[model samples]
Target: MLYQIISFVLEVATSLFGGACLLRLYMQHQRVPFGNPVGRFVFALTDGLVLHLRRVVPSTGRWDMASLVGAYLLKLTQFGLLWLLAGGLAAVGWVPLLAVFGLVQMAISGLTGLLIVYAILSWTQAGSPLSAVIDRLCAPFLAPFRRILPLVGGIDLSPLVLLVVLQVAAMVLASLQQSMLR
Candidate 1:
């Protein structure tokens, strides 16, 4: 029970911080303006780690490599700590692979979350300021799917399709993570 609780808290904290880093990277790639509420919130949440990393990890073209590295580092730390807590020092060699697996899981989960919020906001508050930011963030990911999948009765099903695809990706990631345990 104690281990489970600790694991839960660690997961939540790492996911939020790491997710923020991934979001910052994506936003930068999309050339998203940081003046909006979503941008400000993400900046505030991730600035401390990201700013420090920026000193060492310079951007490549439009990509914010610092943010990506920061997120991966967070996952690595989280898994390393968890391994220590579980008294599994012998398996330390697998930390890097686990961290890489964690990063991919985080990315899929984060996109699924953003798409959910975007879908809800599109229905509830179509003209809200926040909606525009969500749309922009989601547009690049959803574009190819949108072109491939036809809308049904004026309702865009791209998000739903994307969500399903992400879930499948998450399942595959889970299998990879489990394989590392053996």
Candidate 2:
């Protein structure tokens, strides 16, 4: 029970911090001002870690290395706590399949976050700074789809396509992880 609680808290922290870091980095890329309250809050929450990482991980071309590193580290920490919890379950003769399950859960969470951002961008017509940030963050993922789909009747379907793709990826990852556990 204690292990489960610890793992849950760790997962929440990792997701929130990592998501904020990613959003901030995307906003920077989109040239959105960080002077606003939302921007300031995100900066305050992640600046310390991102600033430290900036020295070691310089930006490569257009990519924000610090943000990627922060997200990866957050995922790693979440995975670690999950592994620990799985081990605890195994000790009690519970199913030893939880580690893989935890991984799938984390991946799904990440994909869901991306989808939410994409949805907000599409719905708001990219008006809000948050929407602009999301647009930038999702550009790499949506670029190919946009080229293929294009805008029909002035309605962009890229968001729909992207959401479907994300869902499929999440499902595939979950299936693969479950298979590994078996």
Candidate 3:
């Protein structure tokens, strides 16, 4: 019970900040301006860790490596604490692997979420600034699918296809993690 509670709390905290870090990286990669509400929120949530990491982890091309590292660090801390709570010292060596798995899972989950919001906004609030921001973010992920799948009855199906792809990726990642742990 205690472990569950701590794990839940840590997962929430890690997901919030770690998701922000990932969002920051994607926003920068998309060359989206960090002046809107979502951008401000992400910057507020991640600036401390990201700025500190920026000193050591320089950007590669347009990618914000520092934000990516920050997200990984956040996942590492979460898995490390959970390992400690479980008193699994014998398997402590797997903590880093678990962290990597967790980070990938988080990325999958985050992209899933972003796509959901983008789809919703497209249907209901297509002209808002936030919608534009989301459209830009979703474009790269959806482009290949869009190229292959034309609009069905004038409605874009790229989000649905992308969501399905992400789910499959998540399942495959889970299997890999389980096998690696074994």
For residues 23-74, what per-residue lDDT tens digits would candidate 3 score against the true structure?
Answer: 9999998899999999999999999999999999999999999999999999
Q: Write the per-residue lDDT of candidate 2 for residues 59-90, one digit (tens) a residue.
A: 87767779767766776666656666666544
lDDT of 1: 0.93
For model 2, which pairs clash? none
Give the alpha-carbon lDDT of every model.
Answer: 0.93, 0.70, 0.94
> Which parts of model 2 have CA positions greater than 4 angstroms off?
28-32, 36-38, 85-111, 114-129, 150-154, 180-182
**How many steric clashes between backbone atoms does each model show?**
0, 0, 0
Best by lDDT: 3
**Superior candidate under TM-score, 2 versus 3:** 3
lDDT of 1 by residue, 1-182 (tens): 98889889989999999999999999999999999998998999999999999999999999999999999999999889889989989979988888999999999999999999999999999999899999999998899999999989999999999999999999988987798687
Clashing pairs in 3: none
Cα lDDT of candidate 3 equals 0.94
- Kindly report which residue stretches of model 1 are placed more than 4 angstroms away from their true locations once superposed: none
Model 1, residue 174: distance off in Å is 1.0
Which 10-residue span in candidate 2 carries the lowest summed lDDT?
91-100
TM-score result, candidate 1: 0.96
What's model 2's TM-score? 0.67
Off by over 4 Å in 3: none
What's the best-to-worst order under lDDT? 3, 1, 2
- Per the 3 Å backbone cut-off, how many clashing residue pairs does candidate 1 have? 0
Query: For model 2, what is the alpha-carbon lDDT of residue 150?
Result: 71
